[model samples]
Target: MKIAILVEGATERAFKKKLCEFLQSHLGQKMPRLHFITQDGPIPKERKLKKLVETLLDNNGYHAVIALTDVYTGKPDFKDANDAKEKMRIWVDNNPNFYPHTASHDFEAWLLPYWTTIQKLAKHNLSAPSGSGSPETVNHQKPPSYWIKEIFRTGKRGKDYNKVIDGMAILKNNDLMIAINACPELKAFVYRIISLCEEDKIIS
Candidate 1:
C-alpha cells in the first residue's frame, strides 16, 4: 500500500523502522510507497528506512497517509503541548481529508513508559559520562540504564498490564500515536482501495 507519514522531528526513527519491519513481516508481500513527510520534505530521514519503505511501496502500492508525533508538550510537564494539541485537533477535524488519530503518553505511559523512566536515569546515579558516547548519543542520550531496568521490572509491553494504547487515547488525552499509525490521507486511500479490492473479489 502507498502511504504518507508526517512526524514531528525524527526522534522516533527506531520506532518507525520497527513499524515497517512489522508490516513487512505481517503482509508477507512487499508494501508500496510508504512516504514519510517531514520538515525537509525531500529526504525522509537519513537512515535506509526511507529507501526500504519507498521500494516496498513502489512494488505493492497500498494507498494510505499516516502522521505521527508525540504530544508536543511545549512547556514544563507539556502544558503548552496540551494547548497545541487542542489546536491541532481542531485543524484536523476541520480539514477536508486528513483524519486525526492520536495517543497521549501520560495515559499511555503504561503504553511506553520508557519516556519517563529514561528521564529518571540522572537520579539513579547513572548519569552520562563525559565525552564517551558519540555526538548523537550525547545529544539524545537518556538517563542511565538503571531507569529502564526498573521500568521493565514491572512488565514488558502494555499488553501484559491489560492496557491498550491503540490511538484511542488521543481522543481524550490528545495523543498522536493513532495519527502516526495511520496517515489520515493514506488511511482514507487504503480504505478506499481495500473496499474496491473486496468488490472486485466478489464480482470476479
Candidate 2:
C-alpha cells in the first residue's frame, strides 16, 4: 500500500513518522509505503490546498491521501473549524481513499495530555496552572504551542522546547493509551488510520 500525507510542519512530519512505524509494527507488514509532503507553514488557503491535492492524486500512485492541518491557524476560506471540516469533506467526497484530519488548537494539544511526562523528561519544574492536564482545560484559553512554550520559559529549563527536536522523543517515551483517552480528536484520527489499514488488508 502507498500512502501520501500532507502536513503543516516539521513536528507533524516527525509525529507521523512515529505513527507510521507503530502502524507497521502493529500490522506486521513492511509493504505499506508512506510519503510526506510539508506545506512549510500553516495551511490557510483552502483552494490552493485543494489544487495541490488534485495534482498529487493526478500524478501519484498512492493508495490513500491524508491531509493533516492544525485548526488554530484559521483558514481564509472558512469561518470556523466545523466549516473548514465540512468544506474538506465536500472536497474529499466520493474519494474513498482520501481522509482529512484536523488537529484542534494545534498539534501541541495532542502533547498536552502527556505534559507531565514531558516535564519529567525535560527535568522542568513547570506545572499546569490549572492542576489538570486535560486537553479541554489546557487547550481552552491559549494556543497549545504557546502554552507549552510558556511552561518551558517559566520553568528551570529556561530553554524553549523545539518541536522538531523534542516532540518525537517525548511521544516515543509517553504512553499512547493516555493520549488516546485524553484527546478525542487524536483518537478519532488514529481510529481512521487504523480502519484504513484494516480495510486495505494491511492488518488483519
The numbered model that scores best in TM-score is 2
Give the Å shift of residue 28 in candidate 2: 1.4
Model 2, residue pairs in steric clash: none
Candidate 1 lDDT trough over 10 residues, lowest sum: 132-141
CA lDDT of every candidate: 0.34, 0.69
The residue ranges of model 1 lying beyond 4 angstroms of the native Cα positions read 40-63, 75-89, 92-97, 106-204
For each candidate in turn, the TM-score is: 0.37, 0.83
lDDT of 2 at 118: 69
lDDT of 1 at 81: 27
Could you give me the TM-score of model 1 versus the true structure?
0.37
What is the C-alpha lDDT profile of model 2 across 124-187, one tens digit per residue?
7676546246563444357677767777666676577888877887788766767767776777
